[model samples]
Target: MKFIALFAGLPLLAAAAPTQRALGMPLQGDLCMPFQHDLGTPLQGGDFTAFAWFEHEPIHPPIQARGLRFWVGGEPATYCPSPPVVHCPPGKVTAFSGGGYGLSVMVPGGQRVYVSPTGELGYTQAHSAYIPPGSFLGPFEYTPGIPFGHYTFNGKGFIACPNSKEGPTTWKVFAHIPNAIVPTSDIQDCLPFQAVTEIFGSPPAAWQYT
Candidate 1:
């Protein structure tokens, strides 16, 4: 049961400039423009991968958090949308019954983040992980106006384990900023994990056309 890539051809919408309050500073075009990044393969013990991008929203009232979208393999995880569960063992019951996988996060600001597998994955409780009280579970905070910065998201994903009795294995998940080195202390101590959305910055040149 390998996952497919469903977001391969989505259109890239134009984004507007960030407000002074959003970046804490100002001096350029949209710093946090809608962007996408490849969430390389799972750490070292999983069979699935993911990718993410920001769905741009009109600048007004200032969106509390940018809408982030995630596409796991090609189909949504059991915790996500209508896709059936991937690779569930013959006689084991899954922790979650929606059919996709489950994604949970521990960002700053004491925010409890839960990512539902609705084909497109986003924060259910806190829309965006931007703000002092709500860091994206990493080493950076969301500074208004300065929409460009790196951060890490720590969480877990329940997926099928190839050679184990654990029907839907729980793997530690980490989404990090590009080239960002996660301190050993920041690492979550959990098993059967996978990481997604590696780097988030400006949209790639290739996305300019879409």
Candidate 2:
């Protein structure tokens, strides 16, 4: 079950390098902006290949988003959205290049983040979403007005693995019934894993409009 993205069309970089970003309600005034980031796992010593971007397809501005990607990291893992006053913001989810209300895709998860009664952790993708109820965003290591930075998702940073190979991984990411169950039959997979958003700076090399 390959996941659909929020915004589509933006050409992808080599792999999480530049030209993509997230889409959230951004923090106010000289704080942070959405940019490409790595879903770093401190446990693995940050080795494995897991990246995330706001628009999974990496579409440029002047249009709506195609979709979003989490856990597996799309083609070019990282991305760069529009300006805060224009589009992507600190810890935000960008839906387009230059800022506009666009489509926000839901992978297999529900609209909100939750944990199932059977122990399955559920999450979703949106243009403007709040951190979990009690969970607050970590800190801002951004350069005041920069389009890149880092932060902690606290409890929401948790993720799971699946029984299948790269194919099954997509199932786990999309889940079944939105806030339903994510199966894990692999021992080496879904083993109490978590990650942090590690971002690099946004540059002109990041995006191009169609």
Candidate 3:
């Protein structure tokens, strides 16, 4: 399928400083612009993040995906609560309770939610389909101005920037590897495409911080 440009919010990478940082991921190209979802207006202190993994020989222009991995602080994610309140998602605690981190999982066509207390984000070089059950791969740390995780596959993932970007509203996608499934013949069918939704702070007092 032909690719379509996703235009949302203020372009972060567009600011274009004198020089661009090296994308540590396998792909040796400049970082594409920071991505934002059209769901809401651009809020300060929060920026949408993603990355592009240039395909190996044969495929041109590269591909990217949201390398999503759910983590709550230092542990893996669990099923969201049935009622699914804003502060906590059912039983899962991917982050701290108050002023902590909340996560929503979106698989190919399904969704899962988790909460965290460590303010940590989860990302994996491995795809959700590839991840085995009963595995807890620690949280993915963020390096200011650089991609988040290691370089592996074309998959891309982002952490929700719910709070004030002033203090720690950071989100990024790092680690890009070529997809083994999609061959040169199918690169066109596997171009990067992602739709992510992140809601920070519940309301009222939450609005002030978010």
Candidate 4:
């Protein structure tokens, strides 16, 4: 990026400080922008809050069936008891924040969101897929900068769920992770999606969160 400035009455041009962000990626690039249905828009340039969610089927040992949202594992599960959450995403929480490189994603308490070196999908690189303030942003509004989590370390495998149980399953952020199967018991509003076929192996029967 370049900038214009006046040095002692002379017009001088200088380069802006370089940073990694998700934007201006080639259409065929591994990392792509995510779109949200509730907001009726896709993410814009610059950093912003992102509330992650997806449906939870009872296949991970058969507990209960319901939708789940991305909340910090050490803090609390995503809940809508009365109000929305208030904490902020930590500073310099990169990883998928750029098309080429990413910093690192750390929660408010201190734990970090671990990603695979190959940038495919991973859950056990450390312990859990549960991390905090998992927001996708461009950081640089002008350059459309995307970070590593958006793509991968190698800039090849555009970060996605390869198969069953690769961890934090995602085929790609298809309009918000399989529509966050919300439990009827939870009074929170569930984002709606049009389901033509797969509910991620869960039967269409209604279930509750335990």
Global lDDT for candidate 2? 0.27
How high a TM-score does candidate 4 get?
Answer: 0.21
lDDT of 1 at 157: 25
Q: How do all models score by TM-score?
A: 0.19, 0.27, 0.26, 0.21
Give the Å shift of residue 194 in candidate 1: 16
Worst ten in a row by lDDT for model 3: 201-210
lDDT of 4 by residue, 26-73 (tens): 224333332112223433323212212112211111111112212211
- Whole-structure CA lDDT of model 3: 0.24
* lDDT tens per residue, model 1, 121-160: 2333323333223223221122212222112222222211
Task: Write one digit per residue (lDDT tens) for candidate 3, span 112-191.
Answer: 11111222223332123232333222222222233222211113332222222234322222122232122122222232
In Å, residue 174's CA in model 3 sits off its true spot by 9.2
CA-lDDT, candidates in order: 0.22, 0.27, 0.24, 0.21
Which portions of model 2 miss their true places by more than 4 Å?
Answer: 1-69, 74-151, 154-156, 163-180, 184-189, 203-210
After superposition, candidate 1 runs with Cα above 4 Å error: 1-5, 13-111, 114-140, 145-173, 177-210
Query: How many angstroms is residue 208 displaced in model 1 relative to the true structure, after the best TM-score fit?
Result: 34
Higher-lDDT candidate of 1 and 3: 3
Off by over 4 Å in 3: 1-5, 8-130, 133-141, 145-175, 183-210
Clashes of each: 28, 33, 22, 21
Ranking by TM-score: 2, 3, 4, 1
Q: Positional deviation of 44 in candidate 1, in angstroms? A: 35
Q: Give residue 108's error in model 1 in angstroms.
A: 18
lDDT of 1 at 32: 25
